[model samples]
Target: MDWIVPLILTVITASTPLLLSATGELITEKSGVLNLGVEGMMLIGAITGFAVTVSTGSAIIGIIAAAIAGMAIALIFAFLTLTLMANQVATGLALTIFGVGFSALVGSGFVGFAIEPLPSLHIPFISDIPVIGPILFGQDFLVYLSIFMVIASGWFLTKTRAGLILKAVGDSHESAHAIGYNVIGIRYMATLFGGAMSGLAGAYLSLVYTPMWAENMTAGRGWIALALVVFATWRPGRLLAGAYMFGCISVLQLHAQSAGINVPSQFMSMLPYLATVIVLVIISSDQTKIRLNAPACIGKAFRPAQ
Candidate 1:
């Protein structure tokens, strides 16, 4: 009973990065652009955030730097895929490879270095209210930000006119173009936003979650975020549920091993990833639903009318 609250808190922290990254990618997909370089962008963000924090000793600056680094990599993807009409799949793959190598190179000097963990927020009275207080009010900034981002994403997509236009572009770029929407420009903005969010997720990993720098620190969380978008069927609310679920499984596995549950360490380590595969298979089995919900122009190359 005593361990329950702490376990829930750990799950929330684990889910934050996925929520942020997936939410951002959801917006990008809604705008009819598919960028598969999330892993690369996140890695770049991780290294950049760690490096900047180490250099300046300011976590805030580190987060900003991570966002900028992610956007910079995204800009390359946009230029290649949008401007030159390169294959989105290939360009994205290249971006990931580049990011992994780049992050490794940049993080080489900073390996094993640690930073002060981001301070948890404690409301004057609310955070002191037993179990619920710490669970709800004692989280760091990004934890709350992730929840707000989901709400904001839902509102922007369903209640705002701009969101409708972005969806229109995704549904049919040709139609959107005839209707006077700047498809390329909208996609550019959306892609950059996704990149920034992915970077922010990376920063959370290094600056808050682990509070340190390491090679390939993002691991495969970016890919999991992408899968989450698909699992949620482009719906922000569902995305939140899915992220928390995954987070729960991840924390459960970690604690199970720590508690000496007798499971093999390797098998326990694979729990989160195995769950990802199983969920993806289940969701993808419903081809009709996927077809109906997926953006019509996803992964389709777009060019302006001559």
Candidate 2:
């Protein structure tokens, strides 16, 4: 019973960044743009956030700077894909490669540096109450924000006219353009939003998850988040569930190693990624579900009728 609370807390911490990144990607995909540069964007954000926090000594400011950095990189991707009509898949792969090198270069000077972790919320009596209280109210602002973003995103997608317009563009950009909606403009906005969220996720990694700067610290979680968007079939509620489920798998590996479960350390470390492949295989088997939920124009470059 005592271990349960701590385990759940660890799971929440593990899930936060994935939820943030995936939710943003979900919105990006929903707009019919497949930006596979999420991993790169997250690395950029992680380095920028850590650098800014180290220099400014403020986690909040570091987070803002990270978001801006992510948007800046995402803008590059958008310009190449949307304006120059470059190949989306090629551009995205290049973006990730660029991000990996660029972040390592920029973070070189900051290696081995550590900073104070983000402060958690404490709501007087409520936060102190046994399991339920701490689990619900004792998390950091980013944790709460992640959950709120998912809920808000769900509502926005299902209930708002803007959401409908976004969906319409994703389903049929030509039809959306014919209806007078600015298809490219809507996609640009969605891509930027996704970048911002990825940046925030990176900040959470540096400021809260590990509270330090290291080269390539995201550790492929960016890819996991991408898989999560697909795993959820682009639905926010399922996205939340999937993120936490992966989070649990991640934590389980650590616990297994600690408990001397006799598995090879390398194999234990591979659990999260292994689970990702299995889940993707299972999800991909359901072609009908994916076709029904995935955006119709995803990965297709939309050229507005001149």
Candidate 3:
């Protein structure tokens, strides 16, 4: 009974970064482009965000820098896949490599810096409702906003004009072009949005959740977020569920350590990544099914002239 409230609280906080990153990837994938560089983008965002915050003493500025960093890295992918028509998988792997090396080089100096987290914004009335109060109301603005974004994403994907256009482009880029939509432009926008959101999520972890920048601090959450989209079936509502589920797993690891379980600390340390690998393998078991869930034009070459 005592664990109920705390569990719920931990779930929300833990879910924040996953929710943000997964949701951003959802939108990008929905637009028909497969950007596999989320890991790289997030790493770049984390370090860049930390550097900015450390120098300016402003969390917002740091977040902004992170977003910019993510967008910049993503653009490199866009240029290769969208313009140069390279292999999406290979290009994405390259981006991740670049992000890792770049972040390590840049973050080495900022590894021990402390960041000031944004002040929590408590909601009136709802914030004082006893046991469930803190979990529901006493959260950072981004936390609540993410839940709202989930709902909004659901609505936007199912019942909005812009969403329809994005879907049309995804379903068939040629048809979308025939109907007068600019496929490349839409994808560029989508890629940019994905990058920015990934960056913000990274910044959130360092500046808020951990409040300190560490080398490779993101671990493998970015990869998990990528798998989350598949677990969600490319649906926004499912994205939220996947994030919460992953959050629970993360929290459980800590609890296991606290309870002094038989598992070695090293194994516990690897639990999150291990869980991520298992989930990804589970979701990726059926190549045909995974392909079907993917957007129709995901890896297609876009020739405007044709």
Residues 1-306 of candidate 1 have per-residue lDDT tens digits of 998898988899889999989998999998888889999999999899999999998888999999999999999999999899999999989999999999999999999988888889989999999899999989998888889999999999999999999999999999999989999999999999999999999999998878788888887999999999999999999999999998998788779967979988789878878988998999999999889889999999999889
Clashes of 1: 0
The regions of model 2 sitting more than 4 angstroms off are none
- What ordering of candidates by lDDT runs from best to worst? 2, 1, 3
* Ten contiguous residues minimizing lDDT sum, candidate 1: 249-258
lDDT of 2: 0.92
> Can you give the lDDT of residue 76 in candidate 1?
98
Per-residue CA lDDT of model 2 for 124-210, tens digit only, reads: 999999998999989999999999999999999999999999999999999999999999899999989999999999888988888
Question: Top model by lDDT, which number?
Answer: 2
Ranked by lDDT, the better of candidates 2 and 3 is: 2
Assess each prediction's global lDDT (C-alpha) against the native.
Answer: 0.91, 0.92, 0.84
The CA-based lDDT of model 3 is what? 0.84
Sorted on TM-score, best first, the list reads 2, 1, 3
Residue 284's lDDT within candidate 2 is 92
lDDT of 3 by residue, 179-255 (tens): 89999999888888889888888887887778787777888888889989888878898889889999988888778
